[model samples]
Target: MVISVKLLEGKKVAQALDETMAKRVESLKEKGITPGLAVVLVGDNSASAVYVRNKQRRAEKLGINFQLIRFEESVTEQELLAKIDELNNDSAIDGFLVQLPLPDHIDEDKVNEAISPNKDVDGFTPISVGNLWIGTPMTKPATASGILMMLDHYNVDLDGKNVVIIGRSNIVGKPTAALMLERNATVTITHSHTKNLKEITSKADVLVVAIGRAKFITQDYVKDQAIVIDVGMDRDENGKLCGDVDFDDVKDKTSMITPVPGGVGPMTITALVDQVIELAEGRING
Candidate 1:
């Protein structure tokens, strides 16, 4: 039985979403508003740089007023918090995010909490997370939201499906579980310490992997005809980009799967900019 596999190409989905979002930006402009978004980057993390670049390009292409604030690695915690306060009150900027993995001297949670819940476009704040679980999200974490958006674009109904997410991070795993639950799917979240991981995964109708381990999940862990969404952005042994699930090793057995570079990566930025646009829309509604 040679099962045909469908690739959940997030790049294509992002392009399709961009068309509608761009029009929304244009409409806001006609009403004397241009959606504004900003990112604050500290130090020089290569991966963070790439993520920020992708976001800037997309936001600008949609006619959003994009801002990038750079801070030195030696900057004090108080200074960073002060900047956050400024952006929180900035009327022109609808939403903004501080790039994560900040230097050891800075407290990440403290910074995230400082961003106003309304402008917490990355949805990392406690207020945002609480709201999400309660079914009234102010904004969603970009990567998790993107995953659902891609699934919806493909018309993969989550209702009554068993979703096994192989990560428990606040960013992806927890939020994904919350969103899937709202759609009436039964969700299970597993992490590095999960015992009998394969046993749990092999029973899922849908599997989402975001453990940051290159090619960690293979066909052995997947159920026949299951849908897989890989969120890993790790380098393989040969220094090539690859996902948590080994595409070649698992694709033949799965009904649908996402590729390493063209999958969840692009959709993340699409979801980020979409959140910014929504906040901008609110400005007009009030």
Candidate 2:
């Protein structure tokens, strides 16, 4: 007998988040403290450009102040850092993000560390990362937070569950593991270097794939009735969006799963907006 997987609709969750954020933004506006986001994009990665553009457009729609700073690929590390410094001192900018996948010559860690944690809305700084582990108030990396938000929205409880995440990247895997641990889930993190990845993933009650490879996780990697969340968004040979998990093959085996395009991606931006509103309200009035 084949089982049909329940779709975890991130678009629906994101809309709810937007409604909450919109009201918060309006409240801030009424108090004369307009929440703002400053985005700095280095180089011309097509995908990054599109993401930044969407963020700016959404910020405007919510009546939040938005700024986008574009720099050439040849821009020096010091030049980028200088721009971050300027935004850091600007009182009007409530949150700021330095877009990722920076140029090879630039030290991404240095740039991330340089941003003031108060305005580091991307949540890449060590301070924010530490706060997340400690359950303190800090902006979390939006993608990681989005995953948790989606799980909660679907009424999936993580406590005491065996949650296995594929990938060890700072942006998604490591932070997400920390979040699951905070939720009392026994979390296991695997990477390319891990031997017999399937054995580990098959034991999970919840499986999150963020390895960035298209359709890397198939039905064989999942346990029956496992909750699957795919964080990878890559175009397959057919030019359609595909995720790390083979949706068609694994969906039947899972209890719930997030789709490639409409899942984690949309929720991430919504999470960012939510955090920005929280930050603005906390700093200005709380």
TM-score of each: 0.97, 0.94
**Clashing residue pairs, backbone N/CA/C < 3 A, model 2:** none
* Residue pairs of candidate 1 with colliding backbone atoms: none
- Residues 51-144 of candidate 2 have per-residue lDDT tens digits of 8999987788888899889999999999999999999999888899999899999998899999999888888899998898788847899899
Judge candidate 2 against the unseen true structure and give its global Cα lDDT, from 0 to 1.
Answer: 0.90
Per-residue alpha-carbon lDDT of candidate 1 for residues 12-109, written as tens digits (9 for 90 to 100) = 99999999999999999999998999999999999899889989999999999999999999989999999999999999999999998899999998
Error of 2 at 238 (Å): 1.9
Cα lDDT for residue 87, candidate 1? 98
Runs in model 1 lying further than 4 Å from the true structure: none
Please report, in order, the local distance difference test score of every candidate based on alpha carbons: 0.95, 0.90
**Model 1, residue 92: C-alpha shift (Å):** 0.6
